[model samples]
Target: MSSFCLSKLDHPDLAWLAADRAVAADDDPTRTAAATIAVAQALRALGHHHLALTAALAAADPADDDTVRGTLHLQAGLAAAEHGDRRNAHDLLDHAAALADRHTGDTDPHHTGFGAAAVQTARSLAAHRLGDTAEAILRHEHVIRSDGWRRLPPEHRAAHLVDATRAYLDTGRPSRAGRALLDADRTAPAEVRSRPVGRTLLTEIIRGGPAAADVARLATVVGLTR
Candidate 1:
């Protein structure tokens, strides 16, 4: 969990160290698989997309718990997308979706948060990473419209909103990007203020000219001036 938080906080090196310690401490296959998810996240943060994908795929055990295995596939899919393997990325995500169908509820057992909504959210991010901004926005819209979206953790929603902000920006929609950033801030202030990615996105939105009033205020709150 520390590793996961560290990764979210944009401290990939520290996250990697923590994930390594977790792997060393866990002997159970399922536990180790969970730890490997953190490892893959850290590696992805470090720009080692291929290694991250390989680690996630290797750690996935079908016999393990559904959440853990599905989460592993999700990580692998994201990594694959980042590594430019579009087919493999969607394939892995499809596999995760199938696993999610077997596992109902919005439970976060083992902190995996593996379920249908999570998978759909992952698809949005995967599409974004693959340079399909239109597809990313479409998936994001669908995810948020679903009942499962509201049930996700605040941090998760905020993080996805930040990514969605970027997608909007990429598609020449700064106003929409501003709105998404505001939504992210409302969902989780720390996700906007503490995460480097969020902060950077905020900076981009502000510098792009004529930011929303709320966005400008948020910049001030985060100690980022125009």
Candidate 2:
């Protein structure tokens, strides 16, 4: 999953190359499907949203594993949302939710991280990407209220918080965004200090003026000074 990790690190071009190598090395249907997840992620990172959606959808068909299939649907849903296909995005998310219902607690078979909570978080992210800030914030609040929230991996929770930060910022809630970023840092310091998305959001919050003390400290920690 080097490709997937690379994409998460914002190295889309390297991720794409790694994904290609993964696909070339694996011919197994399930393994190929797993690699396709990385492919879709890299494609999305590169702004090839439509192609990412198509690749995820195609990969889902051959994915016999529930976790892999569900994860593909989530990827497809996010790509569709980024591509501005609202209906398709919602449809794919709903389909992923249905698949998630079959599984019990948060399972990470194939490292897909597909489960009820993951689907819920994906909904929040899709909503945010679709310009539905109200829905995004609502879903995000619902996610944190659920028992599955704490059950998620620190990285997953932290990344979702970063996305939630964007939703809060969109609604002109800089303090809420600041709180989210703080939560993200508390959850996984690297998520805020290392990831480009988190760093950019933190910069935005700082530039908006009058940040909280903790936020200002975090800015300094991340080498971002006002």
TM-score of each: 0.95, 0.95
Model 1: residues >4 Å from true position, as ranges?
105-107
Where does candidate 1 clash, by residue pair?
Answer: none
| Count: clashes, candidate 1 | 0
What's the true lDDT of residue 220 in model 1? 92
| lDDT by residue (tens digit), candidate 1, 1-226 | 8887899888999999999899889788888988999999999999999999888888896337888999899999999999889999999999999999988765656876678888999999999999998999999999999988887788889989998999999999999999999999999988888888888999999999988889999999899994
Residues 31-143, model 2: lDDT tens digits? 88888988988999999999999998898898788889999999999999998899999999999999989877545668777788899999999988888989999999999
Q: What is the TM-score of candidate 1?
A: 0.95
